[model samples]
Target: MKKTQSCPPPVRRAALYIRVSTEEQAKKGYSIPAQREDLEEYARTNGYAVAGVFVDEGKSARKRYTARSAFMEMLEKVKAGEIDVILFIKLDRWFRNIADYYEVQKILDAHNVAWKTTQEHYDTETTNGRLYINIRLSVAQDESDRDSDRIKFVFQNKVSRGEAIFGNPPLGLKVEDKHIVPDPETAPLVRELFRHYESHRSISRAVREVGEQFGRILWLDGTRRMLANPLYKGVYRDNLTYCEPLIPPEEFDRVQELLKERSIRHNQTGRIYLFSGLLVCSECGRKMAGRYATTKRKAHNWEYHLYRCPTAMQYHRCPHRKEVNEEKLEAWLLEHIQEELNAYQMQWEASASAPVRPKVDKAAILRKLEKLKQLYIDDYITLEEYQTDYQKYRGKLDAEQPKPQRPDFDRLRTCLNAEFQTGYTAMSPIQRRDFWHSIIKEIRLNTENSPQILFRV
Candidate 1:
């Protein structure tokens, strides 16, 4: 009698995965209901029990694998041996990128978890099937890239013609017949913004005053944007009038110059920091935010100020654990800054007699324009090519022309020295903040090295 061999039991548990990119949400056959119905029928016929169902809606597969919340949860369950196989509608539905597919394939292989598509014949059980899946993924990724490029080209052409392709105009403007126009109610607020900023020459003060009058807390950034934005002058990013004017162009230009003159460095916040947004963790490169702590002791209660990174505060997962003692750090910074400033002042005195160089690179641009003309004269290019190249160089030359420089060093040095002479800590918080902003460009902190204070050149 011949010995009979018993067959191994078939795998029964399965995890169903369905995904729909934002662009495909309206398409037929990509609907969640259709996918669920097809996948369930396939699972029933294959003698596999539905262990779990994962769906990622309006999510792009082009993003990192970990970004898909449902997919990640399914992967975790697969690794734990709760599911024997993963079933999807198609390989492209799983991933368009080949690199991401392989990374996931390696994980599935290690855990002995097989993956298959209900609609496609490619299987992970054989070598040829795996190769076929890779080829299909490569084609999918190429198509995705081409689609992205087409969308970008269309957007750029629309913007070049000064057409508002995007929906909704920013705060003070409204879309009227596909054109950007000022909102009657909000337009007055925008005009008031410029007038208030021009008078005060302070972003924080303007925000506070305007916010109080309007019965809302106006943001500092919004006020600054209103002052600097060319939209108030009826212009867009390309510096041409694409919308109706709110403030006169002359008034807008004057406000910009005034803003530059009043900039106490880039420090716009009313919140005072002794190190002035300079403290950063060397290990993680995150800024160390200033914080105060109170600890109760047996003898006496203690109050301490500290500068700590997001990692130490449980906001980030970085490994750097060091916290800066605010009092000690501030003392060190003030002393070092004073010494650096004295040396910088001496260097400035030495260079006072030196000749000033032209700020704009006019000569270089003019030379390029001459060379471009020679190319056209020598018939090296067609009339259309010459005209296109000529316009490109001309635009560069126009941009290279000199503009006014601000926060005049002469004025800054005079103001800073007068304030410093009165004693560093003696000045009011705002005055001290302004003084530091004028002199110190940045301050970097490290647990291993001394605090590094970079002064304005």
Candidate 2:
């Protein structure tokens, strides 16, 4: 027989997964590049082909796999049969969550995939190895939990000592030597905002006037938060006196009373907004809130129900300042109901026939927003650029997505019939409100005071 030529074994493809949480990087000096180099060397020494490297920087191994984009992508590649095995530096680097590890391991098992840690020896093929892996996972998770408890204790101690926490100080204050001190530039504006709100007792008016006077962009929610914040009264958490008072305690107390009183009055109002939660502002993609406009005509007060963009009125960031009269909108809807229904049916059919679109990753977008805020605080980008990018990302967050349920077309048709019109007209204000809410999803109001109705369908 002729001598058989020797053939080398096929090289297995390996995917390297690396992760370093912020705390780990700071405390343990865990480096991604170093891990990558070591993993590549391990692969080379094992006679394996390095298929890909996935790194999740500033991400904890305990986080959900979905939240770790790189890890999720690696799983996708494994599912595609591109990866024979996954390699990490240590067991802790692979997972700090036992449940999450098993959840991912199920997928790996189904795909006949395996994972190995270069610095640790634990194989799934043997009972002892599997038990050792479980013990390591438990230890890692316990360590993470303990680390969290310690950090919380430290923060609480700092707060009790009237020291600033490790984050950006609120607006109108700056961090100085681990203490919060007034920023001369914005402190005066904060004082003015409180004084204005105290005197006027109107958050919207105060925010608008203060923003205009100081050339600053003040949002309604932020302004309200500032007014109610105990920090302004030299108190933080339960510390009683955290810093120098921006607004006197008496003034702050009085403003709190005004805010509470206004809120009670608003809640107890007799007026009912027919489309309170069903109107959207076309310009800013924010909800259009209902308000009443009162005028004195012939010595008698006339109250008109209206819907307007609260974002524009309160934040002054949006340009859609025009208000839509509720009566006119109702009349317009009555006249165009048939046409709108037909158009909606066509659109619904078209959408049903079209291919499904991938979902937008809302959690990822929120994480990005937080990162952007941190970047702005670090002075890595200018205010204008930050504002522009912030708005762009916010718009994406506000964009409409597909709804799960279709509209009740049969009930809608019945409600629109001439015979049912009489019954609808006879319904009380509350009943009408309920009926409209049950059938209409939203109505987009443009700057021209026109309404674009979107039915529940």
Candidate 3:
């Protein structure tokens, strides 16, 4: 027992992590070479055997470990117990997001691995040291948020001016002198696409025709978007562009009218339900959709069409007991609508004899144009807000300026009255559904009880 006791050598294995973002490559002391040298010297001074050197170049610390390959590989080695400690150049070089830092740090703590920064000396074994690191992480996170906001504000300011934030313009245009200008070569093709859509009033047919003739593959969505784009008419987001117009404004307006009418026709379905997209479950606040179930009665097949909460039917999230028959729902809605129509008719009759107010054609185009200029002058709103409002008002002005072909009010009134008088029996299911959609916003159904219906009018 008097002999000298021999103790095992201390574990000195360490993994060094270094990160440098794209913008930090040229910054002082943040280059890959500088970070490597500093980490190597720190390891040597501390008597640590460098097990591995993980460097994430052109990668932001704001990103998680999963997004950084080098960082993830380093974590794997730490988990394997190949490294006793992890060393980095600085706190920000380690992590910017506190949540991600805590998540990875939890794993490291479980593996009994210690982490330290060469520049910032702190004992990872102590509570006060961790508190100090957390405070620094909070500062880094706040700085990142502020930097993000500043970048956004600059981008928005540029966009508000209707100047090209990005160098590339749309297919038919090019960025010239920091503004969008029509490209002579592609502009003609854009016009031809719009003309094709206008003639056929079918996006698929237009795409097919263009693809066949031009020897270029054209998609239905691309053709549709080209037809609807206002840039062809020398306007973008309500602001007149510096580019030359590809198509006349009147032609664009006519195309829009055709598109709107076509869209309405597109939604017309043969099998129409009175309450689709209007039904909601009261229990789970989920949309109730049409469901079909079959039963056998003495060798004959019987089918039941019902509305059920999708959450309950698919996920068993709520009680699966709530359901309503389609026929019963339609009957209840028809009865309710009849009462509303009667009240509406009475109100119309009472107001019929009142003096008719002279309709004024509000020159909204001129008014909105002036208001837009005034908004810029007064600085009442940001340039982005002003531009958004200007575009909206200009659209409204254009739509309103064109006086509608006056119809005989008495005849129109008579037709509406006839439709109202016809009631549910005389109308098609599609027509009834459309009528309900126009007036009723939603219908909430509870388990085996009367539904709560909300009407807009």
Candidate 4:
């Protein structure tokens, strides 16, 4: 027989990964040098070449996977088949949760990469290794449970001492040192906002003028958010947990009552009133009532009934009474909207200075104004492009930055294009609903001529 040559053992190029959550600092013994030294020596002894170390330092393991940049990058390279093995000091050094550990293990296995640890030795490719890993994971889970109990104890002790653990101080309130201190720069403005809202009545009237957060003028939605914020009342609300009050909810409660008073004064409820008991019959003095309402699905709601007085339609009869179908009434209202738009267009045309088109790059403005920071990792654009766009966006973000108009009809047109691409015919239903409520008042009809729609002031 010919002499048989000895074959070399397979080379294992391993990447070391280490993670230490807040609780592990005490229990897991997750020191940077200690983990590195153990993993490095373990890789060398196992005939594996140590390539690189990925460390997720001081980050919570419970956090989303993407939150740990190095961990995520390690997975990417593993899936790319760059590393042949992953070595860690121990199983807990690898992961506290079974789901996360298994997910990463499967990815490494798919790429033909093996995973091992110094204390909990598991190869994943072998049944014995898998059994060892299962036991190690159970032990790791026990450690996690103990760590959680310790944290809860500490948190309860803190709460007992009246040491406030409010998530974030409200605007116009700064954490000077540790305790929340009133910010002189914006406190007065906040107080003024409440006063203005109280006196002005409608939130709409005070939205652009409310001197809140250092004279910060608000749009309708922003103003609503500010008003609804419980922090202004000095109460710290972290979801449902109510902590010590900061300002005093009573103050805001009074302001809310004032707002209701103003709303009633303006008679600006969505409900419409035309000839509301205004045209009383000369005969019996029973007030006339409107009983007709129409919906698009089934036109004349009044087909079943009429708008004649309940007394007139029923037992009590009065002269000068006429009945009309609510469905026909609603259709006539649509025609009035077209008429009003035509009249407004003619009036604008007669004006000497035509409303000039806005200079804002509507598409670019909206795209740049988006919450780019939130989409940082999800967006796959080049880093250079992201930086350039972010800088451009930040420069324009300053309130002092010169801008004549925020958005115009041109931007609305762009919005339409974007909406159509998602297999929708028009803007979102939300957009349509908001547009109608903001631009036009309720359509009015007394079962007579066309509808007369009053536009918003």
Using TM-score as the measure, which candidate wins? 1
Pull out the clashing pairs in model 4: 233-248, 234-245, 234-246, 234-247, 299-327, 300-327
Best by lDDT: 2
Expressed as tens digits, the lDDT of each residue in 1-457 for candidate 3 is 5998899799689898989887888765598888899999999998999999999999987767689999999989988889899999888999889999999989999999988889887766689977987888899998987677567655644554667777766667887777677788787777777777665455776788877876778877777787887877877653455346778877787678757645222334344556767787888887777766779999999875688888887898888566789888876755565455456556555666465544434464657656776776587877568768867765565554333333233432443464564564687766666565545556778877467765433
Candidate 3 C-alpha error for residue 160, in Å: 0.3
For model 1, residues 54-90, the per-residue Cα lDDT tens digits are 9999888888889999999998997898989888988
Q: What ordering of candidates by lDDT runs from best to worst?
A: 2, 3, 1, 4
- Residue-wise lDDT of candidate 2 within 383-434, one digit each (tens)? 5677688778777866736554554677678778867567877988767765
Model 1 residue runs over 4 Å out of place are 1-11, 187-212, 216-401, 405-457
lDDT of candidate 1? Answer: 0.72
TM-score of 1: 0.55
| 346 Cα displacement, candidate 4 (Å) | 41
What's the C-alpha lDDT at position 396 in model 1? 72
lDDT of 4 by residue, 1-457 (tens): 9999999987878899888766566775787778888888888787887777899888776556678888898888887778887777766666666777787767776788777668754566679877877777777777767667556545544443334456465656665544455678777666666666654445775666654434565677766666767766654422212333334555577555444322222244344333232223334444445554444555534323234545556774544346544445433433354456556445544652445434555456546535453354455664456557766765554323233322233332443343433443264533433344433433343323233444432
Stronger candidate by TM-score (2 vs 4): 2
RMSD of 3: 10.9
Tell me each candidate's TM-score: 0.55, 0.51, 0.47, 0.44
Give the Cα-based TM-score of candidate 3 against the true structure: 0.47
> Per-residue lDDT for 387 in model 1?
60
User: In order, how many clashes per candidate?
Assistant: 0, 0, 0, 6
TM-score of model 4 vs. true structure: 0.44
Clashing residue pairs, backbone N/CA/C < 3 A, model 1: none
